[model samples]
Target chain A: MKIGIIGGTGDIGKGLSLRISDKHEIILGSREAAKACEAADATVCTLRDRNCTGLCHGASNEEAVRDADIVVISLPFQHVAPTLAGINPTYLENKIVISPVNPMGKKDGYFFFDRPEEGSAALAIQKMLPASAKLVTAFNNIAAHKWTLLDEELDYTVAVCGDDAEAKKVVMQLVSEVSRLQAVDAGPLAVAGIVESITPLVLNIAKFNGLKDVGVHFG
Target chain B: MKIGIIGGTGDIGKGLSLRISDKHEIILGSREAAKACEAADATVCTLRDRNCTGLCHGASNEEAVRDADIVVISLPFQHVAPTLAGINPTYLENKIVISPVNPMGKKDGYFFFDRPEEGSAALAIQKMLPASAKLVTAFNNIAAHKWTLLDEELDYTVAVCGDDAEAKKVVMQLVSEVSRLQAVDAGPLAVAGIVESITPLVLNIAKFNGLKDVGVHFG
Candidate 1:
């Protein structure tokens, strides 16, 4: 399978790109061609460091997903809507689109988040994407650092939610490919708001306690 | 010093009870007599396991703070006002009242916290407690499991917020005794609302991943 990660140059994007590269042909997409190439090269270096046969390439967002079976949007929460608006939803035809964005606000000495009433950022994304696209909300809960550091034996879980069941299954498979990680079905897309909001909770714990990287592991 | 833990049988109460037992006279306060006693006994047992020496006793909420110099209120968000209302404000003179509470709600498939327009839960708690009482908000972000686990070095930073500078110093000393922790002054009591709301963020993260024990640490 060919997988394209739009905005694939971030900490999370790079982490997922590294893990998925071994099982599929991976591409790192960015608005800036130079950044896309840098991200792709960095991911390949990371894969080589892990002694894995993972492969990654660079392309523009459109070109990255052009021939891909799966396209993962890994941009910041604030950027999701406008980024999608710029893309031609028609090109996303029948392809699975996954979003893992959370809203967080920190002011003065307090840290909190504002959740969209439309539910989660994922649902908002799904609503905006073309009807032909299979939208799923996932990877919002997993810590990016955990992906890069922890080996395959540790039991980490990621919740995947989407209106379409078939699309969710693709995400579940992708989750399982990353060693001991499991994908839990947290219902449909409307619930994606809940999944996205959980990030701030994790962030708060990390922020208050001086923890650089923290992930939530369910009982 | 005589320390009062209102709602001491609850999760946060038990955690702090164990940590402070060695240096102070700890009193466990709960709505139920049996539960309060049970909580006191549990803390003693945990202390014994760690080979720490301290004294702990059980009492009703009102009786617990009657003669104590410091009072720690570990009640839930909704019960805070009513619980404190039952006590005599006269007994609160010159005492330090500490609060740690977070309010959360579930919408669709997501979990989020409800924030009052006035700001964080801590600010609300301070408003409810007597003005004569020194109010401080700390330990709201620390995970209960981490507080009790001796094998784990505390990896989180706790932010302390309050109006009384002297009271903040007292709470910081208590926080320091626990080891592997740092106390950061996040400003006055009015800003406490932000600090207290982080609990919902942490809870949401745990809920999404189905995690039992999750905590935050600041850099």
Candidate 2:
């Protein structure tokens, strides 16, 4: 399947591209096509180091999602609504949209975030996007560093949720293909609030202490 | 100095008592005196098993503070104000009172917490205590399991705050003597909100993922 990663110049966008580039055609997309080109070139260089081969191209966000079956929005939580609002709703119809954004605020060496009443970021995105777009929440709890280093078999669980069961199943299949990681079906999109809030906690643990490459595991 | 732990039957109380009993006159105090005695006896047995000569005794909260030079409150954040309110202000005056509590709320297999507008649980206690009473905030960010294990020499930092500089200095001294741990001067009582909020993050990391036994280590 052709996967389009919007905001592809970012750590998350590049990291996700690196993880799945071998099995799928990955396109790195950004507001500026030149920035996306730079990111894709950098990822290609890194992947070449491992003797892996696949296609990872860069283009404008609109151009990237035009021909893709699955679109991953790897932008920060604050950027999601505005970024999606700019895109034509007709083009987004019938495509699987994945959101991994989280809300976080820091002040005076302490950090906290305000969670939406609906309980998760994925649900929030589901509410914002066109009804034709299927929304799935995943990767909010995983560290960006660990996601980039796909070679390591870490004991981590990614909690995935969406209102559409089929959409979650497709994302889960994609997550399983990433590595030895398991994606848990946590329930509907409303549960995304809890999943989104968990990221702040992980970030706090690493910030205050010497914890590195942290990952969440669930039964 | 004769030191007392207000919530002496709980994990933090027993851990602190075990760490400090060797060098100080340690006593356990709680609302239920008999329960305090049982906890002290168990702590002694655990100390003996570890081949330590540390001794701990038990008493009522009222009697515990009546003569002690230092008193530590390890109750949950919700109970901190009332716990100190129940103590005699006259006894607390001119004596050091330490509090270490964090507020945490759980939902959907994930843990998150609400920040009290007053800031942290420690600041709340400081405000609730009599003005003449010396109140210090410490131990809100340390992992209870690492603290309970007396011989593990790991480099970890504890954020400490108080309105009184002298009282904070004394509490820092006690913290150093008890666990031989590094205590970072976080700031005045106002920053207690920031320090206390770190708990939910740590709890979320510990509860949600593969990062167990993870404690904060500030550089």
Candidate 3:
């Protein structure tokens, strides 16, 4: 599968590229194509250090979306609307767009879910895309630093939610292919807020308990 | 410590009585004192079968609150308001009250968080309590059936949240005393919705993935 990750210069994008590029073609995209290319090269180099081959390429965000079977919007919550607005909507039409975005804010040295008026980030993002776009919410609760730690297994349960059944199944399968990740169908997009909120909960737990990079497991 | 359970005839109240009565006196309260007494007898008998001593007693809901240092409201979300209304507010004043209630509803064969207008059950229940009553949320995501199964160890992470730091600390310590249950401070009552919402998410995960009694572990 050709996976396009917008804002692919970040830690999550880099980590995904490193872990998944060996099995799937990764189109790492950024606002600045040159920076994405540099990050892609770094991903390839890092994988090659372990005597592994990484099939990763860099492109402009629009170009990346234009050429992939699935799209991953790996940008921060605040950056999502502006970035998606810049992309041509036709590119996302009928495409499986995965949102790993979590809307969160910190207060009094603790983090809280910055719930959008639309209920959740996924619901708000759904309104911004084409009607035919299959928006699936996955990978929302993984700790940011844990993604880049290639030596550690990505052992976690991913709660996936989407309106489209086929799209959800495809994303769940893709998620299971990652390092020790088990994906469970968490129902429709209407309830995606519950899954998205877990991100901030884990972050707060890590901070208050003096733990590092907390992740969730649904067993 | 004298621990009081408001809806003591249910699975959660029974489980708590069985699990913690050896260490603390458990006052299991129900709308019908007779039913609570029967349930308490059952709990004592169950513990005795395992060669353990159980200091559990039964009382009316109001009597339970009047007699305990800490109170656990184990009632369903819809029943909480009416039940609390029936009890005199004076009994709950200056008490450490715990809410394990998760407001959830099922639709299309999947469960979703039915958020109360006050945001979460904790916040909503807070309004119904006396100003001096210290409200804390803990054990919101435990699988209900797992609680009654004496052979199984509850090796799960419990996210506890509250406004009063001292009350939150006491609740966390209580949570840690449960079987292999580690408690993490999840912040103030404002974000308890995020923690409460996980109950339905886990139910959906268990149903959709063909798993049984899904539980969460934040690592």
Candidate 4:
């Protein structure tokens, strides 16, 4: 599978590239194409040092979106609209889009869900994309810092929510391919707020409990 | 400790009566005193059949509240207002009150969080009680049906949230005493909405995935 990651120099993008590039082609996209290339090179070098082979390349966000089967918006929730606006809308049409963005804010040493006017980050992002684009919510609840720790296994439950059944299945398959990560179908797009809100909940849990990198599991 | 369940004929109340009555005195309270007594009797009989000793009794909601160190409001969200109104306000003063209530509804066969105007059920209930009453949220995300299945262990994470630090600690201790349940301090009472919303999310997950009684764990 060809996976394109917008804001590909970010922690989650770099982590995903290193973990999955061995089996899939990764296009790391950034506002500056040179920075994306640098990140892609770093990912390749890290994998090679471990005696592993990986395929990764870097490009502008628009170029990445134009050439991939799946496009992952790895940008923060607030940056999603402006970033997507700069890219041509035609590139995203009929392609599977993944949203790992979570809107949250910390106050008085505690985190709270800063929901957008559309109820959740996913719902708002859906409005920014073409109507044909298949938007799926996954990886939103995982601790952001944990994604870059390649030595650790991500054994957490990812709740996949989307309106399209086929697109959701594809995203669920991608989620399961990650290290020990189990994906469960968490109903349709309207349920995204619950999944997105869990990010801040886990953040607060980790903060109050003196724990690090907390994630969720469903049983 | 003397623990009183306000809606003692409910599933969660009966489950708690059966599970912890051996260690603490359980006063099961209901609007219909006879129903509470019948449920308390059933719990005692079940425990006796398993060669377990339990201490439990039944009374009116007001009488139960007047005589307990800890009070659990196990009623549904809609019933909470009327039930609490029927009880004397003085009975709840300066006591540790636990709200396991989750406000939710199903639409087109999918469950969504039906948040009240006060933001969450716990927050809404906090408004109805005296200023000295310590309101803590626990058991919000557990599957209600699973509570009565005595043979199965509830190996789930219970996120306890409250503003009162000491009262929150007491509730967390109580939660840990249950069957293999881990209690995590999930910040202040303001964060209760996130915890309560998980109930509907899990319900939708179970329904969409064709699974049974799904629950959450934070690790």
Candidate 5:
């Protein structure tokens, strides 16, 4: 499958490219296409160092959305609206869009979920896309630093939430393809708030416990 | 430490008695003293059958709180306020109070966190208690059915949250005494909403994925 990351220069986008480019064609997209190219090159170099061949290339954000079967909106919650607006809406129509965006704020060294009026980041992002776009929420709770560590496995549980059943299943399959990530369907998009909020919870756990790179697993 | 359970007839109360009574004196308290005694007897009987000696006794809710140093409010969200109101508030003064209570509701076979105006159950319950009482949120995400199954190991990560640092550590120590349960300090009471919301998220994962008694772990 062809996967495009909107904020491809970011940690999550670059990390995804490094992790899955061997199995899927990754289009690393950015506003500045040159930066995306740099990130894609870094991903390729990192994977090659580990005796792995990765297929990833750089593109403008619009071109990335225009050409991919699945699009990951890898930007922060605040930037998602403007980034999506800049892209052509028609390009995203009927395509599966994955959101790992979590709306959160830190206060007194503790993080809390800054939930949007629409309830969750996925719900809010759903309104910014074309009516036919399928939005699925996954990978919201992963630790940021853990993403670039290719030597370590992402042995975590990804709770996938979407209104569309087919798109949800496809996304869950994609999640399981990553390193040791088990995906569980967490019901419809309405439940995305619960999943998104977990990121802040895990962050707080890491902060208070003197732990590092905390991620969640469900059993 | 003498640990008291406010709703001693419940699954969590019975489970706590069976699991920790050997290490700590468990004062099982119920609205009906007879029911509390029956539950205590059952716990002792169950533990004795497995060659595990459990120290547990039944009492009225007031007596339990009056005699114990630590108290676990093992009641449902709706029942918490009224139950606490019925008891003398002085009994809970300077006591370490644990709340595994999660405010949630079900709609169309999906569970959601019914977050209170005070942000979380811990915060709201804090208002009901004396200023010296140390409140900590733990065991909110554990599956109730799993608690009573002595054969199964609760090898799950428990996110413990509280404003009081010393009290949080004490609770984390108690949590580690349970069957393979690892406790992570999840920051202050302000982060309790995130910890409490995981219950509904896990329930949704279990329901949509055709799994049973799903629990969370953090790594």
Candidate 6:
């Protein structure tokens, strides 16, 4: 499968490219095409250094969206609307779009779920896309830093949620393809907020417990 | 410590008595004093069947609250207000109260977090208690039936939440004593909704994924 990641030069984007590039084509995108190219090259170099093979490339955000079978929105909550708007809505129509974006804010040295008026980031993103776009919520709770560590299995559960059953199945299959990552269907898009909200809860858990890179497992 | 469970005839109440009675004195309470006593005796019998000794006793709801150093409100959301109100408020004053109650409702064959107008069951519960009673949220997301299987370790993380730091610490200590249960501070009482919300999310996961006795672990 061809997986395109918007704002893919970030930690999660680079991590995903390195983790799944061997199985799926990874297109890392950025506003600055040159920076995206640099990040993509680094992924290849990092994988190659470990005697691993990966198929990855860089593209402008528009090109990435236009060319992929599935698209991942890996940007911060505030950047999601403007970034997706910059790309033509036609590029995203009828595609399986994955949202790992979590709306979170830190106050008084603690994190809280910055729930949007639309209920969740996925619901908000759904409105921005063409009517046919199948929006799925996934990869929202894994620690971003854990993604690029190939030596360590993800060893976490990914709760996948979407209105379209087919799209959710495809995303869940993709999740299982990653190392030691189990996928569970957490029901439709309406419940996405509960899964997304776990990100902030884990953040707080990590801070107060003096733990690092906290991740979730639903057993 | 002496721990009193308000709804001591329920599954959670019986499970807790069987699990923690060895470490702490377990007081099982119900509206019917005789039934609570019968349940407590049953807990002792169940533990003894496995050659495990547990200290458990039964009492009326009022006696349970009046006698214990710590209290566990193991009732459903709807029953909480009346149950707590029937017990003298003075008996609950300054006691550390644990709430495992999740306000959940099923709709169209799926369960959802029936979020109260007070935002969460915990917040609504907090309003019902006396001013000095320290309300802490724990064990909200664990699989209920898993608690009784002593042969199988309850390997899950419990997210403990509360406003009172001392009470939270006490509760966290007790959680660690459970079979392979790790406790993490998930910040103040305000964030209890997120912790409470995972119950419904896990319920959905279990139903949609064809699984049984689903539990959570924040690793």
What class would a CAPRI assessor give candidate 2's docking? incorrect
Which runs of model 3 end up more than 4 angstroms from their true locations? Answer: none
lDDT of 5 at B105: 90
Fraction of native contacts under 8 Å reproduced by each candidate: 0.00, 0.00, 0.89, 0.90, 0.96, 0.90
Error of 2 at B211 (Å): 11
- What is the DockQ (computed on Cα atoms) for candidate 6? 0.87
Q: What lDDT score is found at residue A60 in candidate 4? A: 99
User: Candidate 6 lDDT, tens digit per residue, B39-113?
Assistant: 999999998988999999999998999999999999999999999889999999999999999999988777778
Candidate 5 CAPRI assessment class? high
Per-residue C-alpha lDDT of model 4 across residues A93-176, encoded as one tens digit per residue: 999999999899989889999989899999999999999999999988888878878899999999999999999999999999
* iRMSD, per candidate, in listed order: 6.6, 7.8, 0.7, 0.6, 0.8, 0.6
Q: Write the per-residue lDDT of candidate 5 for residues B1-219, one digit (tens) a residue.
A: 999999988988888999999999999999999999999999999999999998999999888899999999998898999999999999999999999999999998899989899989999999999999999999999999899999999999999999899999999999999999999998889889888989999999888888999999998
- Write down the lDDT of every candidate, Cα atoms only: 0.73, 0.74, 0.93, 0.93, 0.92, 0.92
Candidate 1 off by > 4 Å: A32-38, A41-53, A105-120, A131-173, A176-219, B9-20, B31-54, B90-96, B105-120, B130-219
- Once superposed on the true structure, which residue ranges of model 5 sit more than 4 Å away at CA? none
* Candidate 3 per-residue C-alpha lDDT over B58-164 given as tens digits, one digit per residue, 9 for 90 to 100: 99999999999999999999999999999999999999999999999998888889999999999999999999999999999999989999899999999999999
Question: Can you give the lDDT of residue B173 in candidate 2?
Answer: 81
DockQ of 5: 0.87
Which parts of model 4 are misplaced by more than 4 Å? none
Candidate 2's displacement at residue A6, Å, is 2.4
- Which of the numbered candidates is closest to the native, going by highest lDDT? 3
Of 1 and 5, the candidate ahead on DockQ is 5
**B124-208 per-residue lDDT for model 1 (tens digits):** 7767767799988888877766766766666666778777889998998888877566676656665565556546555555675
Enumerate clash totals for all models, in the order shown: 21, 7, 0, 0, 0, 0
Instruction: Looking at model 4 chain B, report the run of 10 residues with the lowest lDDT sum.
Output: B9-18
Which lDDT tens digits does candidate 3 get at residues A1-219?
A: 999999988877898899999899999999999999999999999988999998999999998899889999999889999999999999999999999999999988888899999999999999999999999999999999888999999999999999999999999999998999999899899899999999999988988889998999999
Give the per-residue lDDT of model 4 (tens digit) for B1-219.
999999988888888888899988999998988988999999999999999989999999988899999999998899999989988999999999999999999898899999899889999999999999999999998899888899999999999999999999999999998888899999999989999999999988888888998999999
Top DockQ model? 4
